[model samples]
Target chain A: SAVISQKPSRDICQRGTSLTIQCQVDSQVTMMFWYRQQPGQSLTLIATANQGSEATYESGFVIDKFPISRPNLTFSTLTVSNLSPEDSSIYLCSVGRRGLQETQYFGPGTRLLVL
Target chain B: SQQGEEDPQALSIQEGENATMNCSYKTSINNLQWYRQNSGRGLVHLILIRSNEREKHSGRLRVTLDTSKKSSSLLITASRAADTASYFCATEWKSSGDKLTFGTGTRLAVRP
Candidate 1:
């Protein structure tokens, strides 16, 4: 299992401001994903951070709002642009094992609050 | 819409008793996994059962998959107060992307 960490564990930002969450893994991983969890809700996949390529976002989410960058195998970042009250949620970073059957490991998470 | 739906949204069980949660998915999946989240934190993967595997056990946790019914169940034996948290079942479809589709989750409260 890979040990993952996210920077700035949490932050409170003003509406219209932006914050970038960083994810770092102990070992190089093949897949890294970003997820969002609303208050009292389950996780929803935001995008798959692809190394050296553009991130593949899920439906209803756009890159303009959440831009992702995966420059290397061990690190990735998700920037929430033009934050709003609705964007106030826990953003988590998880890494998957390399194979057809996936075993994912998650970081603590970055709690974002837009006030 | 969530690909998976769990029943008994909230469960209250006493310590030392067994806790059971059921999950039903809407699509065919390659594998089903169970995860635990405490206080809305990141998910901790408990166990995973492939479509062909009927059951899987990891320590006090047992997971069963019924592909015919498109459902799965997670049972925690000898529950403890520390087991009080939200449990979720996520699905990886056979023909879908790499993302694991998550369910609504069941909030379990184990009282001492």
Candidate 2:
């Protein structure tokens, strides 16, 4: 099992500003994933961050909007740019084991409210 | 869409009663997983059942998958207030690489 933590557990930002959410894992992981959960909705995969390479984003999401940085094996950051009321959601980070079917360990998540 | 759909969007039941939720996907999957989220926080993975497997159980939770129908069911027995949370079913499809597409989710409220 891996222990995960995120910074700025909850934040309220201006509509046009940007907020960077950091995710840290206790152990070095090969892959880390970012997710968004809007109010009264299920989790949506935003992107997958891997060290030494660019992140792979899902459909309806792009790097320009949600830029990701994976500086090392245990750390990654996701920036929500040009925030808006519709971007008010819980951003979560998770670390998965080697196999695709392995269970993923998730961080508490950063609650972002764009005003 | 590629995402799956879960039935009983909201469920309210007594603490001792059982709660059952169903999920239906559109494509063939290599595996299906169940996760629980408290309030709006991060998700906690509960169980994973492979395509070849029919059923899996952990603690008071039981999951059954039917590939013929592309659907799965989660059953929680003797529930408690702590069990009140949103349950989601995620699938790893054979075509999609490495990411799990989540279902609509079911909000279960266990009354004490």
Candidate 3:
């Protein structure tokens, strides 16, 4: 199992501003992912933060809105640009081994509340 | 949407009893997993059952998968107040690059 942590466990931001959430893992990992969980809703995958390459985003999410950077195996960041009330959600970071059926470990998550 | 759906969106039970949550997905999957979340925080993975596997167990948690029905279930035996949390089932779709599509969670409240 991998231990992951995210910065800014909870934050309140003004609308039109941006906030970047950081995820750090104790051990080097092959896979890093970003997710969003809205109030009273399920988790949604925002993008796969691939190391040394562009992140792969899911449908309904775009790079301009959610820019991601994975400079190395143990760290990644997800920035929610131009925040809005609807963007107020808990952003989670997860890590998994590539090409395996193993469990993915998650960070404690960063809860963002946009005003 | 590719998201899975969980039934009985909310559940309430007394401590020492059992609680069951069901998840149904739309597409074929390589594996199905169950996760637990407390107070809207990051999720803790409970268990994972592959497509070929029928049932899996981890301590007090039991997970059953039925590919024929495209659904899976999680059973927490002898539930405790500490087990009160939201449970979600995520699926790794075949050929989908291991990206998990999460289901609408089941919020369980165990009264002590």
Question: Mind giving the per-residue lDDT tens digits that candidate 3 earns over A4-110?
Answer: 98998999999999999999999999999999999999999999999999999988999999999999999999999999999999999999998797898999999
Lowest summed lDDT over 10 consecutive residues: which window, candidate 3 chain B? B92-101
Model 2 Cα lDDT, one tens digit per residue, A65-112: 999999999999999999999999999999886565777788999999
DockQ value for model 2:
0.74
C-alpha displacement of A107 in model 1, angstroms?
Answer: 0.9
Give the per-residue Cα lDDT of candidate 1 at A12: 99
Candidate number of the best lDDT: 3
**Model 1 ranges with Cα > 4 A deviation:** none
Model number with the top TM-score: 3
DockQ of candidate 3, scored on C-alphas against the true complex (2 decimals): 0.87
Candidate 1 residue lDDT tens string, B40-91: 7778999989889999999999999999999999999999999999999999
lDDT of 3 at B75: 95
Expressed as tens digits, the lDDT of each residue in B1-112 for candidate 2 is: 8899999999999999999999999999989999999989878899999999999999999999999999999999999999999999999898876688999999999999
- What does the lDDT read for residue A78 in candidate 1? 99
Each prediction's DockQ against the real complex:
0.74, 0.74, 0.87
**Candidate 1 per-residue C-alpha lDDT over A16-93 given as tens digits, one digit per residue, 9 for 90 to 100:** 999999999999899999999999888899999999999999998999999999999999999999999999999999
